[model samples]
Target: MKFPRRRRDPVEVNLTPLIDVVFLLLIFFMVSTTFETRQALELELPESAAGTALEASPVTLVVTERGRYRLGERELGAAELGEALSAEADQARLHGLVVEADARAVHADVVRALDQAGALGVRQVRIATRETQATSTQAETP
Candidate 1:
């Protein structure tokens, strides 16, 4: 007597789940990633409610916490600072010069940057500052 053989089923991989997982991962990364415009120098700008928005982008002079001066991305000494300011003088006077000093930076450093700008004939010099937090003030009844 002859025995009958059973046929085996063909193997198949479902790609729908794999594609779904890939899309999920893509979405997760897009949502979780932070997009921040980071500058060459990190600064905690002082807060002020009196700051006015500029009409044009101007040359920014950054003063670090250690009283170091940074013109754009280039760090400069006191001697080199004058040359750098002079180089930017035309643009500084045309658009303006913004002094972005760290909150912890020495006041003398900031003033020195201003003096340099003034000496270079930069008339419009604005200090960079973040907006101050609004405070609630309730009138007291006597």
Candidate 2:
């Protein structure tokens, strides 16, 4: 009598563990990444009765008491401010300017800076202001 022939089993690759590891790596990278630090130019902003905080970061332009202007930390004149802002706009994809003027700076000077930003195709202009302080005398009286 002839012996029964044996059959060979087919080979297969298991991908479940591979796919799980790939997903874990994706999550690890997402959680491990850090955001870039934003640069700001500090100034003593003028007080206002209706000052509000902005929801997003803006490109800052500081005006000092001596009629000096600066973008970030670089000092610029009226003519140079436009060029500097334009360069920043190109780099940061900014469409507006946030003017931080000192309380002692003239109002017309601030307006002129805003006008220059407008001429450079910056459609939106925001003036930075500090919230008005409530005096103790006023609070006690009322």
Candidate 3:
């Protein structure tokens, strides 16, 4: 009599269903989640109702009450004024000049800055002034 052969079944686990389930969960979460934009610092810029739109300026000259000159926070003497502005104008090619002067600044000094800008071929020049109740009060007092 011939002996019957015993058969053994192969052992394996199907991972396609598990991968599909994970992918579906990811897609569901992505669709349901809302992303909020955040900023490091919330800034409120000053509003000027009657102010004209400002164009970019390369050189900013600050004149103190005592007639001291400053080039963007750096103190510049009257002698270096022309040379410095010229260098900036040359580098920028087309440049603008903005003058921010104290209320008590010397008129001659401010005019001198404008003259320098003109000499440097800078066509755009503007004077900056503060707009506030205190400024109006100060003007009324004296």
TM agreement with the true structure for every prediction: 0.65, 0.60, 0.52
lDDT of each residue in 18-136, candidate 3, tens digit only:
99999999999999997642132122223334556576566667776666677754578788888778767864345667777766777898898888888878777777764433344
Superior candidate under lDDT, 1 versus 2 = 1
How should the candidates be ordered by TM-score, best one leading?
1, 2, 3
Computed on alpha carbons, the lDDT of every model, listed in order, comes to: 0.85, 0.75, 0.70
lDDT of 2 by residue, 1-142 (tens): 9988889788889999999999999999999997532234345778888877885445778897777787775898776877787777753345467777988888877887887776667776778888988887755544
Clashing pairs for model 2 are: none
The runs of at least 3 residues in candidate 3 whose Cα sits more than 4 Å from the true structure, single-residue gaps closed, are 1-56, 91-95, 132-142
Worst 10 residues of 3 by lDDT: 37-46
Error of 3 at 59 (Å): 2.0
Residue-level lDDT of model 1, residues 8-28, one tens digit each, is 889899999999999999999
Better of 2 and 3 by TM-score: 2
The clash number for model 1 is: 0
State which candidate, 1 or 2, has the greater TM-score.
1
